[model samples]
Target: MSEVYGWEFSDGPGDHFAVTADHLFAGIWSRPELDLRERRLLLIGALTAQGQFDVAEIQLGAALRNGEFTADQLREMALFLCHYVGWPAGTALDGVVGKVVDQQRKSEQANKTK
Candidate 1:
């Protein structure tokens, strides 16, 4: 019962979709048998295939936090996308990955200083 946007599925349609999506994502993330690295890579590939850049970006961050992928891994994935999904899709992800990499670098630098 963590509150996500203060809305519950039992309330309404919008809430139902949001809650269901959240639960599904939680289930995927919490599957005990799947290794974190495998789960993250699958999620990244799925999101990329679906052309969901925003969600892919979020997943990329999660993957990085979970130690499933490094910034180089993400860049390589983007390049791979360029070959398979076309340059436009890969180009779009470039900015998202850059931002994530920058933020991660800053966070690491701050931690090192601490």
Candidate 2:
């Protein structure tokens, strides 16, 4: 089976949405013309462009964990976003991506220790 995170949110008030999103991501999102990495990048860029920092943070971490994007590539994407989305939005995205990278690194280290 494919790995999916964020369904951990399924025990709370948002369970319905979390399950629905899981289904979409594992099922329909995989049948698209675009590849997984490209789709991830699109979602990341869209979320960042809209200044959806919290949601983007989760996705950024997932993207990194899934090997869809490298930390350097994410930073480069943020710079690309800056030109189109304005400085403030891009700067906010940078902060979120940085946090997600740190979280990903810690998660990797923790897994290694286990």
Candidate 3:
């Protein structure tokens, strides 16, 4: 939600559609048909399959922060993805997930020491 690529809906032409799409998806996700964890797992699979690492990283981060997934579970998921998405995609996802877990640990430690 924080400025995507530093561009906001009021930034210029074509921005409106981007904002609209974001809002629409938010509303769609608000429905109770599916658990948020399930949606996040599906998104992680889709993004990883599509080789959308950056987007996948964001979703994975959310999954971690929200307690939807643990680091060990994510690593297991990455391994499971390898058979379907190929080693490179799975490896890239693992790298990103590892970094996210590391960041979370660092942040937690920092807070504890304060």
Estimate TM-scores for all models: 0.69, 0.78, 0.80
Better of 1 and 3 by TM-score: 3
lDDT at 3, model 2? 41
Model 3 clash number: 0
Model 1 lDDT-worst window of ten: 1-10
Please list the Cα RMSD from the true structure of every candidate, rounded to 1 decimal place: 5.3, 3.2, 4.4
Candidates in descending TM-score order? 3, 2, 1
Whose lDDT is higher: candidate 2's or candidate 3's? 3
* Candidate 1 residue pairs in backbone clash: none
lDDT tens per residue, model 2, 2-104: 4433334333366786687667866767776877777778888898778898888877887787788899999998889999889998889998888988888
Clashes of 2: 0
Clashing pairs in 3: none
The alpha-carbon root-mean-square deviation between model 3 and the true structure, to one decimal in Å, is 4.4
TM-score quality measure for candidate 1: 0.69
Q: Give, for candidate 2, the lowest lDDT window spanning 10 residues.
A: 1-10
Pairs that collide in candidate 2 are none
Tell me how far the alpha carbon of residue 7 in candidate 2 is from the true structure, in angstroms, after superposition: 7.2
lDDT of each: 0.72, 0.79, 0.80
